[model samples]
Target chain A: MQKDSFRVRAADLLDIPADIKGGLLHIEITGKREVFIENHKGILELSENEVTLNAGKETVRVLGQRLRVLAMNNNEIRLSGIIESVGFVREGSSCSQL
Target chain B: MQSAVNFVRGSVLLEVKSSYPERFFNLCARHGIEFWDMTNDGLGVFRIRMTVKNFKRIRPVARKAMCRVHIVKRCGLPFFLNRFRKRAALISGCAVFCIIAWIFTSFVWVIDIDGYAELDTARLLNELSKQGLRVGTYAPSVEMENLKNNILIDMPELSYISVNINGSHAHVTARKRTLPPEILPSELPCDIISDKDGIIHDITVKSGTPEVVRGETVTRGQILASGYVTGRAGTTITTHADAEIRARVWRKKSARMPKKYSEKVYTGREKDLYTILLFDNRIKLYINSGISYTKCDKIIKRTDLRLFGRYRLPISLERATCREYEISKASVSDETAYDSLSKGLMSSLELPEDAEVINADFITSSDEVFAYATLTAESIEPIGTKREILRNG
Candidate 1:
């Protein structure tokens, strides 16, 4: 985990996108209509109001209304609905990233 | 459009049932089994759409995820083609129709000529027919550029020409040469003189001074009207003479009719010949043995097969009917000859339609009869011959 954070910090210092570094998860949100998570492990939970995706050491939760998995693969999952908020929970940590 | 293409390429709607359908989707994604439009039905059943090829590849992955996959619908060309194979005649008929249409389009059926005037239409058609541009001509065999050049070379009167072949019709357009104006003799000052000796029945003067009045006896070469006119101011003006003179003329016509004549009578012997005409070539299909008819008249009829009431095929069936007649000698009585001679003399005079027949006399001789008729006809013919005016300088 320390090594991953150091790599992310190095990427940020070098003014390079973190998604290109291969270890970080890439999440793209289009307004409140859709959420695309790349470089993810699997779909951990799915429901009408929210969807939780496992992205390596982080758990990404998308909160919305009438959420559905539009498409999914091994490393990517696309969720579509009226997305209200998104939160990421790092494994073994209480710090929240939104 | 994308879904239609997918349907054409074969796609299936699938329902995956399991405790964790999400795990099944992830497994599908891992194995590159592409799917879209995923919706979760209640109680662990998920519906999705995938290509037929990808759906087949997802069986092992679904087994590993402890899920059961069921096909809800199948679509696309292959499935529709399996149904289409049952009607063999319909499919073959469509194919044959296409081939026939293609073959017929390659031939010219109707030849149309446009923008033509002052030229004999039949003569122009005859010239074009010689160049193989007539109806039923094969389009590919016709070189349009060469044909235009040939037409221009053959018809010097044509100023502009073009040959256009559209679909099954060839349109030929041409412009004829305009001739120069004519200089007529009436433009000169002349006198209208009498060409025959008769009593004047009527006289009409358009641009001349009248010299003779109606009911006056005139001899040949006598001036009926003069081009020199005296105006109201007593000035003499020279003009082109134009006049029409109708006169009461006497004509004597005679005709001799022979007492013996021969007429043709039907012999009841006939023959029929059948032939096939392909374009300009004729092939006889039936033969007659010793067709020796002394006097016979033959009639031929040709029929062509047309497609859709407009397209005429080159092939045609021709039927020739020949009827034989025999000459029989018959003797006409003197009375019959007298009657025929009178009618013959009336027609031989070629008198005017309103001509008054004054008298008819018939004289019969041996083996021949003669009839004479005197007719007074109102003739409106242009009997005035132009005479140059003598100028006294």
Candidate 2:
């Protein structure tokens, strides 16, 4: 808890955004047609209905229909199709919170 | 945009079959090897497009990920060059053709003369050649202004001339000089006689003696004024006769206007013929041969290509349209004939400005008609005749 408080204070002091300071993955959705994820580690599970990505400390699960992995590199990955919802799951935390 | 760049540099599509294809992407990114357009086949195979430079680097990453990589397709200029590397003659021929085209365009290949009907084309072309404006000559070497002046000095018959160079063609336009009416000098002894039979109305003698008076009838060739002015003491002064005599003259002019006349009427039917003109030779491409028109008039239109709106090409396309016409008999009333005859007679008459038409009498026959018109005119015309005296009159 103290380390977490120190990290938050250091983030405020350094004038860095939360997503950048924590090395969190940034997800951008354009009108539910496309989704872009930056700073992703790798794909944990991929399918037409659901795509789960390792984004730093959390797992980003994307639920959609006919979801396609349009393009990908180390920095970012672009997903296209009907995106219904995006849920984040922390380690030892239930996935239903997000 | 990225795909277009990659296509030019040459790229390949790879099909990677693995349980975890995402690991291959992460490995490629870690090695700074960029790839895009990734697709998951949902059956443990993923298709991705990557540049040729990075394709070899991806093998190690695919091996580490335990994914089997296979080239699905290869594209771009590198592939094209490899496929056509054996056709040496075709490549050289294309190069030679391009070089020849460029060289030919630098010189004038065609000389076209427009608006020159009365002037001789051969003579104009010879003069143009002397002035460095001719076919097969360098287009930029011809000085247009200097050539224009030189041509005008050499050919006084041409009033205006313009030289235009369009691509591989040279266009020359010129206008002919119109000469003034001929006049005879009054140095020789001459006679002024009546041209037609008339009743003398007035006479004005400038250097001659008056012969006829008003109300006096004069026939054709009758002298209205005398050139010999007899001075005092019987010594006659032979002079160039000058006089103005106005007379009321009558003339009969007739035109046969049949009640029914055969005329050529346009039927609005036409046939077209197309031809290609290369240099001076013409090759007919399409023509209608079955046309049977009793009378037809043909109109021809020739078009040549102009490059950059300034240069003209030697090649031309010609289209000839033949409009068909037929002879048909038509009838008209006497009143219509009279109106037509009046207009026709008026146009044919060379009457003076102040002349007055007194009366017109028309005599219409079954197949012919005659018109007798009496006119009065005020004229300043010489009517005196001079005959050389043979030492005794």
Candidate 3:
């Protein structure tokens, strides 16, 4: 945790984007229909209603209806459907509600 | 769309039946296997599309994930061509058609000639054929400069000639040579002579002494003006004679017409003969026997076959139509015969445009089968014609 905080402070001092400097996850959502996740580890869970992916430091879960994996490659995953909400699950903790 | 790119590179749609579908998906992603349009059916079955090459490399990943992958569909050019592998005739036909198209476009099929006046086109075509530039000749083999020079040498009447080959057509543009105007030497001494028997009605001399006056009768070959001029100090100076002499002349013409004439009456009988022409070879579609009708008119028409309404083919169809008629004798009234004879005599009397006719009279006579008429007319016309004066040393 201390190392991560020092890296974040260095990024702030240098005016660099935290996602690129710290190798953090970058998520882009378009309306309520699509979501693009970059810097992802892999898919943890996939279903018609929800999809959970492993980011570097946390787990990202997307809740939606008729959810599908539109495309997936090494570093990015694209999910598409009528998105309802998004939440995060920290290590050794249950899901944090959105 | 990515689908279009995948279709060109050959793609496969596979259905994966796995108890752990998420592990299969994550394995595919972790190994850098590109896939799209992935869907889950809640029955441990998932469908996804990927390129054929990438699909071939996903076997190990699928085995590690304990999934059964079955290709549901295959789409692309290789699979499409495999369907026609057993039909040899279609493949050969396509190859033959392509070869024929290439051969046809390499040679000249049509020859178009333009700007030719007072020169026969068939004769020029014959000359061009002799010079190795005819239809069906290979276009690339023709040496344009040499062909132009040889043609100009063979036919000097052509002032300018150009040969342009565009695709399967050869365009030949030519211009006929124009003869220069005749130059007359005005410094030489000349005299004006009377060309017909007449009485001089008017005389105007510009540069010489007048030999004949008004109301004077003159015969053919008589000089109407002299080229000798009396200059100062009694010196006789020679000059070119210029004059306009008008005279009164008489003309007579006669014509004859028959009271009974033979006219043709068609009986509505015709025969058509066809012949097929391939290049210079003529193939007669009918047997060669002389025409049955002795007194018949033949109308021949030639139609050239063309491709796509533009490229002219070497083959043509010729149709000859023979129409038959019969001759019948007919009689006319004496007044009608006389009028016809008079019209013929008037047309036969060719006069100059400036000649003014003063009086005309016709005499008519008829026998049993023939009628004759005589016409006499009087007119005033110019009578001067130039004659170069011959001087002896």
Best by DockQ: 3
User: For residues B227-298, what per-residue lDDT tens digits would candidate 2 score against the true structure?
Assistant: 677888998776666777777776666665666778879999998888888766889886555558768988
- Give candidate 2 regions above 4 Å deviation: A1-24, A94-98, B1-9, B111-131, B139-166, B169-393
Candidate 3 local lDDT, residue B125: 94
**What's the CA error at residue A30 for candidate 1, in Å?**
3.7
Docking outcome class, model 2: acceptable
lDDT of 3 by residue, A1-98 (tens): 62566777888899997667756788899999999989889988888998999996789999999999889998899999999987788678877856
Query: Per-residue alpha-carbon lDDT of model 3 for B1-393, expressed as tens digits?
Result: 865666678878899999888888888888889899898778878999888888989999999999999999988866777788999999999999999988988899889999986899998999899899997899999889999999999999999999999888899999899989654478989888999998999999998889999999999999999888898789987789999999998889987888899988877899999999987889989896478887888899999998898678888999999889889999988899889888887777777788888877999999998888889988898997877887872
Q: Quantify all predictions' global Cα lDDT against the true fold.
A: 0.78, 0.77, 0.88
Instruction: Find the number of clashing residue pairs for candidate 1.
Output: 0
What range of 10 consecutive residues in model 3 chain B has the weakest lDDT sum?
A: B2-11
lDDT at B371, model 1 = 30
i-RMS, every candidate? 1.5, 1.9, 0.9
Q: DockQ scores for all the models shown?
A: 0.43, 0.35, 0.65
- Deviation from native of the Cα of residue A33 in model 2, angstroms: 1.5
Candidate 1 vs candidate 2, lDDT winner:
1
Poorest 10 consecutive residues by lDDT, candidate 1 chain A: A89-98
Q: Between prediction 2 and prediction 3, which has the larger DockQ? A: 3
* Residue-wise C-alpha lDDT for candidate 1, range B170-263, written one tens digit per residue: 8888899777765347668888898887788789999889898898888898999998999999999887788877776655555565566788
Evaluated at residue B79, the lDDT of candidate 1 is 77
**Model 3 docking category:** medium
